[model samples]
Target chain A: MAKIQIIVICTNLIFLAFIARLIIKAKLREEYAIVWLLITVLLALFSFWRKGLDVVSKLFGVYEPANFVFTGFIFFILIYLLHLSIVNSKLQKSITKLTQELALLKEQLKETNKSKIN
Target chain B: MATQLLIIIPCFNEEDSIVSLLNELNQMVVPNTFIITVAVINDCSNDNTSVIAEKFSVVVINLPVNLGIGGAMQTGYKYAWENNFDVAVQMDGDGQHPPAELNKLLQCWHNTQANVVIGSRFLVNQGFQSSLLRRWGISYFHWLNKFFTGIHIYDSTSGFRLFDRKAIELAVQYYPDEYPEPESIVFFAKSGLSIHETPVIMKERQGGKSSIRHFYQLYYIIKVSIAMFFSFIRK
Candidate 1:
């Protein structure tokens, strides 16, 4: 294997090991850890099979394999960002609902206390 | 059945204008209404807005953190939905939306039985016309909305609006986090909800700067246009 390919594979393996540690330590949820593990594995696979990216790029009519890799990385990042935004939006909605309910419940409790005292 | 109306005024540091606006609302009576309650969603205002709002008969929902106008308004809608309010009206707390014109919206709601009734300034060209740049921005969105949804809402950016039970229910579930007014019109129309626009005069804001400044006008236009485009494509 080429020195650069070996380096890439080693980096990917290190990242995979780090993610596994996080998963084992319960720092990252299993669902997200699975996604990270899959990405790392794919990176290691591509690094081991250096010609695989060129083959896929050629099949997809991409002239430059490096450009294809960058584009794919960017596309994945955008999808992940979009997913995070959706989750953030859902959490925002639920938080707003909870705050409203808490405010109303506080008001009700105040009214009840006042009536009881009267 | 007599309509139970909840007027939701989303205020953020409007210390100068809120008191007088609340007083104006206090005196004005909407005819043919069963119960009228004014509530203020104090969006974590740094000023004494909450104290002033509480001085009146208004119910104040003091948010622990700032949620901007859209989130604050959604809280009010959720309150209306849970409290069994037949209708909810969104009026700005900056004293721009005239309380006297509220009856016109209620009347439109009664007559058309529409899911949402919007108070439009461009319909009759009455009251405080916005700046030239702002008006141009509004016209762009107006045209974009027509092109996208085939619906003509002259003032899609107007916050003065009346929402019926169905509309309130929908908004309570989900509302755009920011710049929601224009996007909401397109959303409601696409969702098969009936929307009616009534001509009403609006005054210039009494105090505090507008969230969208002159420098941000271009950015606002681009952001809202992109947001509308996404809403159009999204299922």
Candidate 2:
């Protein structure tokens, strides 16, 4: 029981700190803050809810809540990391596409400028 | 004044709007004193996007395979970097980014000496029209960018922008395919480049539906937030 209470308090404090940091120091995008807030809340909920873990384990035919929660946390983190990797890949590619087009346009302009000067 | 400005337009199966966009660009009448180049990155487009771009005298780069926007743009950058250009602008092929207004961005960077100058529709009440849901998404992105990058971003996800030689060099080497705008901001910031925004009027696209993947925006927000939070401290 005490462990659950400590987890809950820690989670709330972490959330408070995050919010305060964003408001006071971080000039980050609001959309990004929403995403972080959601994730933090989700993590907090997962950390504290013993019944939720037990139910998830029972539903999945697992016997131990600790194992179930631990496994679930690891799985979720892995998926999220993969998701970030995919986004990073896509962002990089888009920049490349636009950079290429811009370079070509500038080249044509250069030729035109040279021709006119001559 | 003695710099070459290249504009890369990434199109994915854009047939209907490609022609109009090309015409607009050609009609813009860039000052003869300012050298300009326009390259269309066709990401293995299944449609006539390549044919249309080529016909307009714009250099068309057809990617051997679909690399999405990031992949297509990377191909463009590699070409630009290899060829040695002074500046690069990223323009969407969806007929939304006004080619005529591109000079505004160039001028902002030229005058202020900023490393990056992005066309910001939010700066002007141009009555930018989009689905309410999309508007919400854009707002969400704007917020997300501020949280992660520690920069007050006027346009968090806009692709219409100009980059200096330094930015182009960095982008070609490290940019990712998805979430290009937010992720690149972090890259530029981490590398200690000054980023700027210029207000521009963007017209609603006339054709070729946006191919944004389902749930990509949400997923991107979470991923980028974490990445930037960590990358900010580490790099």
Candidate 3:
């Protein structure tokens, strides 16, 4: 019923719709979109249940509900960033392997062509 | 029995010294039983490095994209593996690693049968000992590497190294992408490969700038330190 709760509810609703549009347009893959959707839905659930955040924070032994929300979101972001770095490292290894293989194959092809001429 | 020795020269933009280095290598004498083959991995140099190397009778692999020294060296190792080379020696294209002293590495390998042989400038306490600041950095890595792997490498950053078939296979499987020298020593030691160090004189680079610059000293130290740690813990 409070103005802040209504604002939070409206913001999360808009975010959910935006994510749905992205998924529908094939702009976001399902694996990644799942995380975003989970975040938005969690925020929406807390906004709809007025005492939800306060109860959760108290259960987690945090003195302030707002501090808990900030810390929780930051923790999520850090985890996601770590996942991204792992993926990036794998991609880099693959690219290096591919480049090496391509160069080797090209050299082999040249040798084959040279021998054919002789 | 003939030993297939493949010398891997990973070059960047070393047009000034590539020709002379190749000539020196060609002129170097090895034992009768060893058949030496030189393979230069040009790391997408903008200069005429690949062009000049192509004129020689060596294998020249030109990577389309610049994949730093680690990637370039890995390419050479991959080639060595595929071609069934018995031993692979890595030397700089800048002519710092003297071809005349290659016997020291071969002799060490012959006597000790080490899986990997490193040519250390600091072993004899002589010859082109880098600047005071660089020496300090090398010493730091020496101690750090010793602490982690329980193996002491006097010149851990030396590019002059020889890898036998087992070492070459390991290199092809996984190699550090950037700043790999010191970190790789630790990795090889941890992987149960026997490593031996021999004294070899290194000359000041004939041409081309050193890869490690003054501005990037801190970054290099931090990156290598982190890489060493990760390599230690890697399964």
Candidate 4:
């Protein structure tokens, strides 16, 4: 009923719809889109059940519900960023390996061609 | 059986020195039982480095993109691994690591059977010993490595190194990218490999700027320290 709750609900609905559009267009992978969708749906749930967050926060032994929400989101973001860095490291290793392999193969090809000419 | 020695010289824009370096390397004398091959990993230099290197009998690995010093050197190691080289030496492209004194490193390896024989400029305290500031930086890594790996490395950052097949195999498997010399020493020590230091003089870089520039000293120390710490903890 609160204006803030109504705004939160509307925003999450729009975000969910946007994510759906992205998935349908094949712009976002289902695994990655699931993370965004889960966040939006959880936010919507908290907005509708105003007392849910307070209860959850109390269960988590946090004095303030707002603090709990901010900390949770911070933790989630940190975990997501860590995931991204792991992905980036793997990508870098792959690229380095690929580049090295290609260069070596090219050298071998050149040697073969040289021997053939002889 | 003849020993295959690969001199891996990773270069970036060393157009001024590559020709002479290769010439000197070509003329260096090795034991009749050892067959030496020079492989230069051109890190996508925007100069004539690769062109000149190609003119020599040495193998030039022209990287499509610049992979910095660590990646470039690893490419050379990979080549050595692939070609079944018995020994690999990492020398500088800027002519700082002398080709004539290479015998000392190879002799040390043969005598002590160390997995790695590092050319330490400080062992005899001669040749281009680098700046006072760089010496202090080198000492910091030395102590840091001793603390983590329990191995005292005199010249931890020396690029002039000889790696036997075991060390070469490990390097080809996993090597740190950027500022790898000191970090790799720690890595080698932690991997239960024997390392020996021999006194070999190194000259001032003939041409091109040193990879660790004036401003990057602080970042270099920090990054290498972190890399060493990770190496210590890694399985």
**DockQ winner:** 3
- Report chain B TM per candidate: 0.98, 0.91, 0.99, 0.98
Quote each prediction's TM-score.
0.82, 0.66, 0.90, 0.91
- Which lDDT tens digits does candidate 4 get at residues B42-89? 999999999889899989899998888999999999999999999999
Listed models, DockQ each:
0.36, 0.07, 0.73, 0.71
Candidate 2, residues B61-172, lDDT tens digits: the string is: 7765566776677667776787788888899888789888888897788789988898888888684656767677777767766776767776767888888888888877
How does the DockQ of candidate 1 come out?
0.36
lDDT of 3 by residue, B1-235 (tens): 8999999999999999988899999899989879999999999999999999999999999999999999999999999999999999999999999899898999999999999999999989878999999999999999999998998898999999999999999999989889999999989999999999999999999999988898888789999999999899988
DockQ-wise, the better of 3 and 4 is 3
| Top-down DockQ ranking | 3, 4, 1, 2
Error of 2 at B127 (Å): 4.2
Better of 1 and 4 by DockQ: 4
lDDT of each: 0.90, 0.76, 0.94, 0.93
Off by over 4 Å in 2: A1-118, B230-234
Error of 4 at B151 (Å): 3.6
Q: In model 3 chain A, which range of ten residues has the least summed lDDT?
A: A41-50
Candidate 1 lDDT (Cα, 0 to 1): 0.90
Error of 1 at A115 (Å): 3.8
lDDT (Cα, tens digit) per residue for candidate 4, span A1-118: 9999999988988999999999999999898998998899899899999999999999999999999999999999999999989989999989998988899999999999999999
Task: For residue A16, give model 1's deviation from the true position in Å.
Answer: 5.2
Worst 10 residues of 4 chain A by lDDT: A37-46
Backbone clash pairs for candidate 4 read none
Writing each residue's lDDT as its tens digit, candidate 2 over A1-118 gives 6776687768777786877687667675675577677767766776677478778789999999889878977997798789789988678656555555564565557568868999
**Per-residue CA lDDT of candidate 1, range B88-138, in tens?**
999999999989999999989889999999999999998999998789889
